[model samples]
Target: MSGISIVGVGNMARALAARALAGGNAVEIIGRDRVKAEELAGTLDGVTVGTAGAAPAGDIVILAAPYAGAAEVVREYGDALRGRIIVDITNPVAPDLQGLVVPDDSSGAQEIAGLAPEGAHVVKAFNTVFSHVLAAGPAEGRPLDVFVAGDDAQAKARVSAFVAGMGLRPWDIGGLAMARALENVALVELGLMNHSVKHTDFSLGITLLH
Candidate 1:
C-alpha cells in the first residue's frame, strides 16, 4: 500500500482520506490546527495526524486546500517536501463560481508548482471531482476520471497509480502546461452544475466504444 499524507482537514481532505483508507494506504492528516487534524485522524482507521510545517512522512502528499492556501502550504513546506510527489488538487475558480481566477497563461496547479520545493513534483489531479461524488464512489456506474498533468513523468505515473488504486481512472493530459486547461474545464463544469446540470454528483470521462 502507498503511504499518503494529506494537508488540510476540509471536505476534500476527509473525502480523500476515506478513499485512501479504503485503498489500504497509510494515511496521515496534517493541518494548520493540530486539534482538527487529530480529530479527523481519529475518525479514520490506521491514520496519523500532525501540524503544518512538520516534515511529511508519506511518499505522496495531497494538498486538499483552496488555490491560495495550496500555494502558501507549498511555500511553507519548502525543502521539507523535497523528494515527494505533491498532488495539487485545487481549482482556481472565481469566487462567483462563474469562471477561473487564474490567468489564461497559468493555472492553480502550475502556480503551486512554482512554489514547491526543488525536488517536490507537483502533479495536478482530482480537481474535477467533487467531494460528495468521491465519498459515494464511482460516478454513473463508472469509475471517476482523475485528470493529471505534471512536468515529471514519474511523478504523474505515481499519482496515476494512487488514483487507480483508489478505483478511479487517471488520465494523463500531458505536461504541467496542460494544467491550465484542466482548471478551466473544471470551471466550465461548475458552470454546468449551477445552470444546466443542476447537480454535483456527475463526473466527466471518455466513453470508449471498443
Candidate 2:
C-alpha cells in the first residue's frame, strides 16, 4: 500500500481518498479550508486531514483541485514536494466548456510540471474518469480504465499499481507528453455528456476481444 496525500477537499479528492483507503493505502486530505478538509476526512474512515502548504505526509501527492487552481497549489507546495510523485488530475477545460483552456501545444499536466519544484515527478491520471463514476466503482461491470502519463517510468508504474489495487486497469500511454491526448479525451467525454449521452454515469474504457 502507498501513502496518498491529496491536496484538495473536492469531489475528486474525496472519491480518490475513499478508493485509496479501500485499497489499504494511507490517505490524507489537505485543503485551504481546515474545517472543510476535516469534514471530508471525517466522512472517510482512517483518513487524516492536513492544512494547505504543510509538508504532505505521503510520497505520492495528488493535486485534485480544479484546473484553474492546480498551478497555485503546486506553487504553494513549492520545495516541499521535491522528489515526490505529484499527480495532476485537472482537465484544463474552458469555463464555456466548448474548448480547452491550455494551449494546443501543451496540456494542464505539462504546465503544472513546469511550475512544480525540482525533483518532483508529475504524472497525469484520473482526468478521464468522472468523480461520481470513480466514487461509485466500475461502470457497466467492467473495471474503469485509468490512463496514466508521466515522464518517469517508475512513477507511472507506482501509480499503476495503486490503480490496480483499487480494482482498476491502468494504461501507461507513453510519457508525460501523452497527457495532452488524455485531456483531449476528457474534453471529448465532456462533449458527449453534454450533447450525446446527456448523462454522467458512463466513462471511457477499452474493450478487448480475445
Candidate 3:
C-alpha cells in the first residue's frame, strides 16, 4: 500500500485514511486549519498532520474536499503537486440537488484535471461511495465497487491497486472523459439518498451472477 495524503479533515478524508491505514499505508492529513488537521490525525493512530501549501509527502494525494475546496487546494498546491497522483473524489452537483453544476461536456474530475500541473495525474474515484458507508465497512459483506477514470494508465492502475488492497473492487471505466458518467451516477445516488431511499449509509455496488 502506498502512503496517502488527504487534503481535508472531513468525513471522506477520515474514511479514506482509515482504509489506507488498514491497508498498511501511512496516512497524512493536510488542511487549511492546522488544528483541525491535527485533531483529525490524532483520532487516527499513526496518522501525520500537515498544514495546507506544504508539499504532499505521499505519492497519492486525495482531494477529499468539496468541489470548490478541491479546486482551491489543487490551485494552491500548484507545481509542487507535479508527478503526484491526484485523486478527485468530488461530485459537482448543484447545491439545490436538482442537477450538475458543470457543463454538459465536462465533469468535475475533468475540470480539476485541467487545474492540475502537467505531471499531476488526476484520477476520479470514490465519488459515488458515501462516507458513512465507507466508515461502516463493506455493505452486507459485499465489497464496495469503486469506479475509477483517468487519462493516465499508470495512475489509474495505482488507484486500482490501492482500492483492491483496501478490500474494495476498482472498475477502470476508461479515460477521464468517463468521469461525466461517474459524476452523474453520484448525483443519482445523492437524489436517492435525499428522496426515495433516505439513507446515507448505503453504497452503490454491482452483483454478478455466477
- Against the reference, the lDDT scores of all candidates come to 0.89, 0.92, 0.92
Decide which is better by lDDT, 1 or 3: 3
Q: Say what the RMSD of model 2 is.
A: 0.9
Model 1 lDDT tens row, 57-151? 89999999998888899989899899999999998888898777877788888888888878889899998888998888885577788899999
- Candidate 3: the clashing residue pairs are none
What's the TM for model 2? 0.97
* RMSD score of candidate 3 (Å): 1.0
Give the winner by lDDT.
2
In TM-score terms, candidate 3 sits at 0.97
**Mind giving the per-residue lDDT tens digits that candidate 2 earns over 1-210?**
999999999999999999999999999999999999999999999999877888899999999999878899888889999989999999998888877888889999999999998999999999999999999998667889999999999999999999999988999998898999999999899899989999998989888987
TM-score for every candidate vs. truth? 0.96, 0.97, 0.97
Error of 1 at 22 (Å): 1.2
Count residue pairs with overlapping backbones in model 2: 0
Q: What's each prediction's clash count?
A: 0, 0, 0
**In candidate 2, what residue range of length 10 has the lowest lDDT sum?**
95-104
